[model samples]
Target: MQGPPITIRLLLLMLTSVALMTVDHRQNHLDTIRAGLSLVVYPLQYLVDLPSAIAHWASDNLSARTTLVEENQQLHARQLLLEVRLQKLYALEAENARLRELLNSASKVGEQVLIGELLAVDQDPFRRRVLINKGSDDGVFEGQPLLDAYGVLGQVVEVTPFTSSALLITDPSHAIPVQVNRNGLRAIALGTGEAERLEIPHIPNNADIQVGDLLITSGLGRRFPPGYPVATITEFEKDPSQPYARVVAEPAAHLERSREVLLVSRTAEEPSP
Candidate 1:
């Protein structure tokens, strides 16, 4: 055959040179030259890749509807599973709440009571107050005693048109007349702004109080019903030379955690005097 045309021969020589350069660069023998050439060709390489990128983007855009449908189905299935679990949880919670109410009702032998839900907790860190869903409209009055499944929570402090506020016994401003269940030693349990503890002040060092003793409302002030639990002695410090012992008690009621409460009405003979 006749010798290849001059232009074709030159193009073949250029291609051969490019291949040799590529091999040398891969072997790290022509790194500097290859890096310079790459920099020079970078814009051209990007321009060449633009067509393939556009094609990929168009393909994905065209298939978006199908992809979205598949993703939506997956999400709906997950939502259904979550909703079923939520239903079971709600049922369990309701059943537990109803059982607690039954227990409280059985314990209050002669008192009239109305069940109320805790609406909100006090925002002030200093005052221990809880808002209940009941108010004057529901026969809820100020000073009505609030109780949970275990013991006294507090008493109604303020009654609004549709809601009532309860001042917890753990409020610093509140104090309940209490007695040691074991020895029947009477003392006032004063709130110290602590959520779960109370202070029994002026208890004589010789008093028979001890750790683990149960403190119950003595009903001396007639504010709280008699025999209702208030706190349990958790710490007792008796100094032989001191006149008074230091006693710390933990509240027996779930005052800070309970979601429901019972508003017990005063007995007919026990009306406010």
Candidate 2:
């Protein structure tokens, strides 16, 4: 029993001496000894790490097919959804182009029309203006009229080198001359800063205008073209003894929601006086 205990003690002492020598050689001024020991131990390090590397490679190889299949399915579904949307967009664009062509022909004024894309709406809800992707270079001028496919949108308020700002007809400061299409009753449609509505001020209480009457630009001031749709009478209130009637009309064009518009050039062919 004494002999076995002495042998175990000697083994422990030898292991502790080796660990101390390794630490000193690696950390202190013994590079030559450290390099030699590293070369001897390098094979064991590789052997320990080899199983983990092999397992990782094998796992990737086995899952590659399933991963590819799932990715392919997702891509195909996205492609199908985009294709359907594209088809509808194409049809809508074609219809818009045809209607614009007819409008240009019917106007007979020969004004060169430039199509502009809406860039942004004003951050202030009270101000009804939009930024467009056209400017002086595209023949857009300040005070030039803008219109959508349905009717008048607004006038150019600010012109820049690359873009311009349009004040919509619903702006609080905007007003346009309009005539009721039903009975040719002329009135001024004033913007109330409401999103899709305007107010007709100073109309007599017994005016011929009805709740469903259509209002079109009368072209009296020549700011807007005549016969262009402006608004539709939506609400009207008349007090028997009041001096003026209270009337509200909804705009015919998608003033707040329109994404595309035509910037009518001010250079329309003038007829001889």
Stretches > 4 Å off in candidate 1: 1-95, 98-107
- Tell me how far the alpha carbon of residue 179 in candidate 1 is from the true structure, in angstroms, after superposition: 0.8
Best by TM-score: 1
Candidate 2 C-alpha lDDT tens digits along 1-273: 345687798999999889878888788756777799999999999999999999998999879978999999999999999999999999899768756754654365446677788999998977999999999888788887788777788899899989999999999999999999998999999998988889999999989989999999897776676788889999999988889999999998878666778777644453211
lDDT of 1 by residue, 28-52 (tens): 7787887999999999999999999
Residue pairs in steric clash, candidate 1?
Answer: none
Clash tally for model 2: 0
> TM-score per candidate, in order?
0.69, 0.64
Which residue runs of candidate 2 sit more than 4 Å off their true CA positions? 1-110, 267-273
lDDT of each: 0.88, 0.85
